[model samples]
Target: MIGEMKAQQEEIELLLSAFDRLVEIPDEERVVFRTLIERKTIPAQSHFVLIGEPTADIGFCLSGLFRLYYTTPDGIEYNKNFCGKNEFIAAYSSLLMKEPAYFSIQALMDSELLVVPFRNFETLFDRHACWEKLGRKIAEGMFISKERRERELLMLSAEERYRLFLGRYQHLENRIPQYQIAAYLGITPVALSRIRRRLT
Candidate 1:
């Protein structure tokens, strides 16, 4: 039990360090943040959030990978984004609108996450200016990522997008399935294969 507690403390410190990189989190605030966190392990292929469910927590990936995707009525799934270690994942739209999530966040690998209720963060925002700034910065980053993704989908060729994907997720290529990569690039696996052959 002591060992487990020590491990959890280390994880909280790592999360606080990551947050410190974005904005200074004072020691007192860090303590409060620590109190809000719950360590969770999601098995590979399991979901952190499911479509049509209200999302209540935001997760910071401690290890492993996750994919955020939307499924069509006919049962086709499209990858919207991937979250890797040291990154945040959440059903942002659902949290913002107080509605059920339109998509799901699934673990691509057995994953460890530092989870916190979104309401807890909101409470912190009211307590400290630093928390408010952190929230704003995080939102801004999410918006920029969304806009860039939209632009890539609208203006770039599949081949061009594939190149960009290779650059952005070079570390993840071997870790993820080709079919999912193709999904993210808005192409089929066959198309991705052709593109890869052409590149080589």
Candidate 2:
């Protein structure tokens, strides 16, 4: 709900390339555009954004972990996302519609982020075609990953899910705890242990 982040005014060109090759931005235009970036950092177990909260900023992680989750009537948590370095983190649906969000983002580890607000995003996109391309590519990438996860969930067994989890996020499995992995996989910790034992 807060648009407190101010563009660093120095890192835009470098950040832009994180989304795409950015060979299209003319040198003169790029020098001008570089003045519009800002950095944001969110701490562990903290809310980067909450359910029903306004979505204003689009953020890219410089480091650390965050998850998107929703609570059920019985107060159980279901994590729908896991993201870290170089990843873009935002409630895309809410950001696109300029509405309140449905999912809550909580940092699993201390995080440093780079962000551009909706106002700046709109102004930049309208004025610079290069920024628009970067935005479009980020959205497309997120869509592809979401679809892939949906297929994996529908087709894979629980044990297979655990194996795939390891294969996909090798860095995360070793860093986070087993219980968190179980929660992400929709399994009990005991079952996860059994799966691990079988693998060994």
The parts of candidate 1 lying over 4 Å away from their true place are none
Model 1, residue 154: what's the lDDT? 99
Summarize candidate 1's per-residue lDDT along 1-200 as a digit string, tens digits: 99999999998888888778889988789878888999999999999999999899988999999999999999988999999999989998789788999999999999999999998889999888999998887888899999999999999999999899989999999999999999898889999999999999
Model 2, C-alpha of 131: deviation from truth (Å): 2.3
> What are the TM-scores, per candidate, against the unseen true structure?
0.97, 0.86
Clashes of each: 0, 4
Best by lDDT: 1
Which candidate should be chosen as best, given TM-score against the real structure? 1
Q: Per-candidate RMSD vs. true structure?
A: 1.0, 4.4
lDDT of 2 by residue, 1-200 (tens): 13332334323534666644633665665665555556777989898889878978888787899988877768777677798887789888888888898888989999988777767777777777877887777788889988987887788898898888888887898787787788778778899999999999
